[model samples]
Target: MKASNGTTQDVGGRRKNSKREDESGRLGEYGQDSSVNGTKQIGATSADSSGENIIRTSVTWDGRSDAGKILEEVLLLKQQFLDYVKSHQGRLEARLDESKKQEQKFLANAEGLELRLRKALTIQQTKDESDNTEEPE
Candidate 1:
C-alpha cells in the first residue's frame, strides 16, 4: 500500500502501499462503486458462513427522490387500516348491544304470556269443577 508520497503507511496493522482494491479488483472505498452494475458487497466472511453464528446488519438504500413519499404512503396505508378496524369494532359493539336488548325484550314478553296462560288455565279448571259439583253428584 504505497501512498502517493512514495511511503508506506501502517494502518490497523496492515501495510497499505497502493490504491485499495475492492473485491471486484476495482479501486474504491467501502461504499463507493466503480461501475453501474456492480455492488460493494458487504456480508458475512468465511468465518461466519455456517449456521453457527448470527450476524446483524442493516441496509442503507442509495438516495432516491421518492423515498420519503413512498414512506409517507406506507404510513398512510397503515393508518387507514387502523381506522377501518376501529370503525368496524364500534359498529360491531353497537350490534351486540342491540341484540342483547332484543333478547331481553323477547324474554320479558314470553314471561308475561306465560303468566297470563297460567291464570286462564286456573280459572277454567275452577269453573269446570263448579259445574261438575252442581250436577247430580
Candidate 2:
C-alpha cells in the first residue's frame, strides 16, 4: 500500500497520497527528477541546477541547392499537368463541335423528309378527288 517514496497507494495500484512533495516542493509522483547522472535534466533549458552550461544548435537548408532542383522538377510537372488538361479540353471541344454538326445534319434530313411526305399526301388527295368526279361518266 506504500510506494518506495513514502506515498500511500490503493489496492488497485492507484496513488492515494494526493500531495506527495519532493525536495524542491514539487509533486514527487509527477515531478520525479529526470536527470541523467545528475548532470542534465530532461525537458530543461540550456542551464542546469548546478549552473552547468549546455549548447544548442540549429540546422537550415540553402535554397540554391537540392531544394531548388526539387522546385524546378515540381514546376515542370505542374506545367505538364496543365498541358495535358489543355490538350484534353481542346479534343473535347472538337468532339462537341463534331456532334453538333451531326445533329444539325440529322435535323435537316428530318425536315426534308417531312416536306416530301406533305407534298406526296397533297398529290394523292388531288388524284382521288379527280377520280371521284369522273365516276359519273
Candidate 3:
C-alpha cells in the first residue's frame, strides 16, 4: 500500500516510510543538525503524530552525491572478500594433501607389520614340526 506521503524503497526492497534526509543531513524537511565531519547517518522508523509511516533512510555523503565513489568502495570490498576466500581454499587444499600422504604412510607400515607377523608364524610352525620328527631321546 502507498501512503499519502511518497515513500522510497530500500536496497532490501522494503518500503521506507516517509522520513528522508536531504544531502545536507537534515531530518525530514524541518531540522538543522550540522556535524563536524562530512559524514551523515540517518536510519530509523516510527509513526509520526499524524499516524503516518515514517522511515528514515541511511545514506553517506562526503560533500557531493558521487555514485561512482560509492560503487568503487563496493567493488573494493568485494575483491577483498574474494581474496580471503581464495587464501582459505589454498590452505584447505594443502591440509588435504598432507592428510592423504599420512594415510598412505600408515597403510604401508601396516602392510609391512602384517608380512613380518606371517613370516614369524611360519618359522615357529616349521621348528615344531622338526622337533616332532625326532624320536624320543
lDDT tens string, model 1, 1-137? 54757787765654667664576656436764345457545457674366543433223455655788879999999999999999999999999999999999999999999999999999999999999999994
| Candidate 2 lDDT, 12-77, residue by residue in tens | 765788775565555445555665776746565443334544332222454545877778999999
Q: Give per-model TM-scores.
A: 0.50, 0.49, 0.52
**1-137 per-residue lDDT for model 3 (tens digits):** 43445874444455668664475564354455444578653434243144444343325354677889889999999999999999999999999999999999999999999999999999999999998988586
Whole-model lDDT values for every prediction = 0.79, 0.79, 0.76
Query: Predictions ranked by lDDT, top down?
Result: 1, 2, 3
* Candidate 2 steric clashes: 0
Q: Candidate 3 overall Cα lDDT vs. reference?
A: 0.76
The C-alpha local distance difference test score for the whole of candidate 2 amounts to: 0.79
The local distance difference test score of model 1 is 0.79
State, as a TM-score between 0 and 1, how close model 3 is to the true structure: 0.52
> Which residue runs does candidate 1 get wrong by more than 4 Å?
1-66
Model 3 lDDT, residue 80, Cα: 100
Clashes of each: 5, 0, 1
